[model samples]
Target chain A: MGSSSAPWKQLLLSSIEANSHLKHHSYFQLATVSSNNRPSNRTVVFRGFQDDGDKILINTDTRTRKINDLKHCPFTEICWYFMESWEQFRISGVVDVIDGTTPDPLKLEQREKSWFASSLRSRVQYVGASPGLPAVASEQSSQSPSLDPSIGPVAAFCLLLFDPHQVDYLNLKSNERLVFTSIASDSGKKLWTSQKVNP
Target chain B: MGSSSAPWKQLLLSSIEANSHLKHHSYFQLATVSSNNRPSNRTVVFRGFQDDGDKILINTDTRTRKINDLKHCPFTEICWYFMESWEQFRISGVVDVIDGTTPDPLKLEQREKSWFASSLRSRVQYVGASPGLPAVASEQSSQSPSLDPSIGPVAAFCLLLFDPHQVDYLNLKSNERLVFTSIASDSGKKLWTSQKVNP
Candidate 1:
């Protein structure tokens, strides 16, 4: 929403660009608090940003347990490690779940866009049996579910917008750490501030 | 504590063995709830297991914020991803902090053992300025702190014993997932059970 890019966003974008060669660099760990207050962590793929803002985009299946976890507690943290650069970014944010059940039209359109953005192979998984269930004998084989990509997002396809308020960036190679925090401004917009700290 | 190794432990050991070539294979993300009930996560090195038990060992500096988070909420989750094997393990457990103030002699011995097990280079960081603090001009240089390894753990060194009660193992290549849970037995022992689930 600001004219200039946030300092943390610039650093994060540079880190991502530096490690673009590694295929697995797109994967990061997401931590969420369950209803019982227990923490749950899992690996999730980075889909990109939301509307050129600090909101991080992610795609998930509606049937996954993390979806329920988000419902109970929207606060989450993303721990992304760039092996090549030896850097780690721990982004803490609130997740806005944009699923088929969402009431907002713009959010639903974003969900549809994200659904089509995914590769066909990745999209087919949403149509299969729900995650964490006992594998059905017939669906055990390497079979792809027939689906028309033009039909837009299926019911199970979901999108997550992680609106980050704090980012803890640590570069192991340089032994430097910086924390970026977003503060609500007078105009209802967020302002970012960064401080250098010992790693 | 049992005659046979737990199923999840065996699977995790196999994954570690398979990815031993990767230098970062020992690194994993630890997520803990802060005092404010927000989730915070960061990467930590996996020291080893505790005395052939399921308790995972990790060393950290007491000056780090994670130490305070663990104090507020002992429950944490360890998310480990083996890139080569494309396997992920999510371990949820309660952390038992073995710091300098702990009273038990056996736990203090374990903490001391963990201290000696860490490399000299790793141990020196604890003796320096606290993490996430403004870097002092004097300590900003490449000077190494002088310390005798024989002296054992410093006051800043802390040991965390993650006693996992549940593990979620996912193999991307095989499209399979398994949930391992530990239940308390009649004799005050823990028994593990594994169930196959969809990825």
Candidate 2:
């Protein structure tokens, strides 16, 4: 069974709804360990869940350093805070990068769909100069030509599928915390166990 | 030289001030690597800068898992987002844990001052059950006695000093990004170099 059947998904969905008013609610920090064993973190906009599963969707430029870090070590932690409710969800998982060269048919389709789901403005960013490179003065002033949405995700547009193994949910308002862990069952199914803990 | 003298400090301060109206601006996400090599992340309240330096101050219970992670690996990354300005500051640093057992007199003094700086309600949490433990019904309902403010930090109260070496500042509103790196001079002074990068 996919993580959609996981027990923590409901609580996560509810928390998202609770903080829907805030535009930044969908933004979260993703942490990964570089090859040198140093921790790196940055903010990424939540693209949405993949096919009703608990796997998170995050879009990024393939040229970014995080892509290289993920190649070295797929393990990652996502820290998402819901300001209105003062709730935090720390999800620990391994990320799978689905880029232009992805071989999986299903993943490629998902990546293509995600490309079209993005706003034209967001898609424009992928066609521009590579992220983290020194900005070119001439390119900065030039108007970005609109991307052909039908062409699918640009080479630079990469989709990260975060497959979570653990979710630590903390609600400050209730002064409660719960940890949900995913376990593989004898039938090769995914099962989640949750325990209430002190916040 | 302290991180306060770094060039990125000014931009960080301005972003913090721009979002001062939002109470949650003081909250940031901290990422660390566990001994097992997996990345761990959580939201941490920003206490303040240490003295006139950019050593970031954060408080946590000694019983928390983060303390163990720090003991195993001091390297950490702090991701702070300012919603109003649509800016993000990713700081890479090594963390110093200062608890009651700390031998450094000056470090212990800072920890004591940090303890007193916390609100009475916050101090009461240190006297309660250890965090991340299963909640006990009786213990959860009982009223927590006020902690003595005069007494120094409780054994559980720990201070974390984050000494930053690199800062990545991204401003989405202006579509600009800058990287600040700390370089040590031959005379032992810390100097910062910044480069404008594509967002």
Candidate 3:
């Protein structure tokens, strides 16, 4: 029952603060379950996180394999590497999908804008009107909308919320590995003691 | 039948050149097979690559789970991500463990020095008297000549070499994903072109 004031807690906070660019780090290696329960991994960008550090948010297209996997199995592990320092942070947690119906409007707007900016609308059209859709080519050829259209109302996007249960922080400087397990109780949030593991 | 001058090849060459930091970017995600045949991935630093991009090398301790898995299944996939930009490269191929007995003295020296610097002799002493053996508390009190020495010599330091068979280059900016497969012949001395899958 150690408090969050432990050295490990400070280390985690300082690491993230010192490496502020990690927030905008383009890709994170995401591990998800496949149809047969096998694991598959891909890189995805980091969106942001909550102020309380209770949850982290990421954006992904609906067409991606990870989105489909998240629909089935919410358990996931995310690996983030800092290129400059050769430090790594591994987080294992449960993922929750947040859609337009989410309570917070600010969160919804941020998610929508990010998704829209990352969409492949122009490229999708260049590839010729969605491969499988039959009638779309004819309709598009008849009266095509401009290439750079406004974010349409029909566009659908979602935000993924990752609540970490365990975080393994490894610093290559001293080849040191530290594991921090986060537990939330009725009183408040508490981080257990850190264990030094073999690197 | 396309030549190396194809768009994908140019794209890859340009990406590698533009992102010069990538060559020095140490962290890479490595996927290895577990006992259950499932894939387990973790971060490892990139040591170097061959002149022709034929082989990629990584420094690993014999005690790591990845090295153990490689003993059982030599097939692995390495994912390299450049955080500053949305560029990622995936290399899947067979792994060859190169030991100190390797003919190339330069490679041997590089591997040994990497392991020595990474060992942090202080922590190695805490682990145990024998280099590879874990230090037992009772045996910890016993003094041995080996105890004063560095673990680099006795440790089974090996270089994990991955000869690329398939490569997937993804540039999120242009929404372009390029997949290239290579065919190796003559004991990996010569390579041939294979089909390029649509990305």
Chain A superposition TM-score per model: 0.96, 0.95, 0.67
Query: Taking the tens digit of each residue's C-alpha lDDT, what string does model 3 give over A1-199?
Result: 4444434445655666666665344457876655555445677667656554657777644445666677777877777776546667777778877666668877677565655555555324332332212233355346544444454323335568887777777877765677777666688765565566645
> Per-residue lDDT tens digits of candidate 1, residues A21-93?
8768899999999888878899999999887788899999989989989999999999999888999999999
Better of 2 and 3 by DockQ: 2
Second chain only: TM-score per model? 0.96, 0.96, 0.65
Model 3 spans with C-alpha error above 4 angstroms: A1-13, A21-26, A33-40, A50-53, A68-75, A84-86, A97-156, A182-191, B2-16, B21-26, B33-40, B50-53, B69-75, B83-86, B94-155, B182-199
Write down the C-alpha DockQ for each prediction: 0.81, 0.85, 0.14
Instruction: Tell me the TM-score of each prediction against the true structure.
Output: 0.96, 0.96, 0.63
RMSD per candidate (Å) reads 1.9, 2.1, 7.4
- Sort all candidates by lDDT, best to worst: 2, 1, 3
Query: What is the C-alpha local distance difference test score of each model?
Result: 0.89, 0.90, 0.60
Misplaced by over 4 Å in model 2 are A1-4, B1-4
Residues B1-199 of candidate 2 have per-residue lDDT tens digits of 3443778888888988999998699999999999899899999999989888878999999999999999999999999999989999999999999999999999999998999899988998999898999988998888876777777789999999999999999998888899999878888767888888888
What TM-score would candidate 1 get against the native? Answer: 0.96
Residue A82 in candidate 2, Cα distance off native in Å: 0.6
Best by lDDT: 2
Model 2, CA-based lDDT: 0.90
